[model samples]
Target chain A: MVLKDILSIIFISLGAFFMFIGSLGLIRLPDFYSRAHATGKVDTLAIILVIFGLVIYEGFSVNSAKLIIIITFVALTNPTATNALARAAYRFRLRPWFKKDKSKKIKKKMNWEIEIVLFICLLIAAFVSLYVKNLLTAVITLSVFSFFTALIYIAMGAIDVGFTEAVVGAGVTGVLLIITIYRTSRRSSD
Target chain B: MHMFFIYVSVILSVIIFIPLYRVVTGPTIYDRVLCSGSIATSSMVLILMVGVIFNRIDMFIDIAMAYSCLNFIGVIVFAKYLGTLGSRRKNGT
Candidate 1:
């Protein structure tokens, strides 16, 4: 029994340690694929370890049998599901993050030039949407406009307002407009 | 030993927030979904450890199993939803 206690302790602690590492990687990793890699791979080993420890602690019993089943289920299912999500994300065109040119060492102020340009593009999207003849294009462009507005609020440090704008302005309003267009007509006003 | 379980669970609960930070401010929906899946996975372990502390692991084991199944299904559904949503947007636009 003492041996069982020690073994369970060792296993569960190791499981917890790996779980921490996985979660850390999930947050700190630079890209979606890397984050997925962290969680998908590390958590599987961590869960199996933790559950195996529980199995050892429980000994030969119906509960242990059930735990073994869980281990099997988790082993087979976790990676498959994570892979599915990753593949779907790729299909969705959620672009990967890339580091800026290392050799150039551009000034931070210079970065604002691109930000300003993109901001102007977003502004033009709003105007273009107003004049666009196609309702679908207008709705999509308006969504982009609202999303840019949310980004501006976030930059100004009003996180709550930014989040609200992102949710209500970009997400909810866009969906409603799309639905309205679909149900009524795909035509926009002159 | 019980004290040990308490310590580990406490530490793990704290660790959960790392992924949650990503879920909240993730740049894309994929990041949010990925972090959420991680959080759910960690929660399964947390639930089991809590069960051990309560000396009701048999009950908690069942709960953990259910959580695992739910986690898998939820991610799969999310993938399907995003797949179709993307295609619909493309076809519509």
Candidate 2:
């Protein structure tokens, strides 16, 4: 038990460090491309480490194997798809960060307000659904407010749904938004 | 077991928020997409960890597997559409 505790601490701590570094890169990096490097690359590594720690805590369950497999597949595919998209952005003349004053002539164009509103609305709805008294309301609300519910589910140990929600709700939806935006607007509208 | 799971989840939860910020504030479309993809991947692991905590490994495993597949396909489709659309706009067609 002592050995397991120690191992769990090490894995979880390592995962957190990677997440911090990835976020730091997001803030510190000068350009969008570099920011992608921080978020996509380092974040992936951090999650895998965290998952490993969780498996140790669970002590060899059937579901743990599935989680490991999912992690492996993500590790393989995320970077490649991200790279393709980034390269495409560059091909379409998306701007990169510069050492000196840049964007003197570049046009600023993205409207982030819509996204902000969407997130806020989602947040409120998710909270309300959680507090409602019906199991059906809870599950349906979970589908609508999938992201937050999934996090809670993690705490409650509903591993499968949480895993699904994380990927589908957060990951796929994010990618879809980017793809939709790039397609509708030019590569770097803003 | 409970303590072990809590520590792992807490650490993961805190670490992943950083990448989430990047996805939110990313300057370019591709950068945002990449960050999103990374988050998706990370969340998969996090989800599985949650399963371990709850002791419902079998149920969570299926969902995680399906989600990974969806993430991969979604990215490719979006990429292809964007690539083609960019060309169309350039040609003014």
Best by DockQ: 2
**Candidate 2: Cα lDDT at B85:** 56
Which residue pairs collide in model 2, if any?
Answer: A63-B57, A109-A190, A157-B54, A159-B51, A160-B60
Model 1 C-alpha lDDT versus the unseen true structure:
0.69
Q: Which 10-residue window in model 1 chain A sums to the lowest lDDT?
A: A104-113
Give the CAPRI class of candidate 2. Answer: acceptable
Model 2 chain A weakest 10-residue run by lDDT: A104-113
Q: Candidate 2 at residue A36, lDDT?
A: 65
Each prediction's interface RMSD? 12.3, 8.9
Q: Point out where model 1 deviates above 4 Å.
A: A101-190, B89-92
Q: Residue A86 error for model 2, in Å?
A: 1.3
RMSD for each of the candidates: 12.8, 9.4
Query: Residue A162 of model 2: what lDDT?
Result: 62
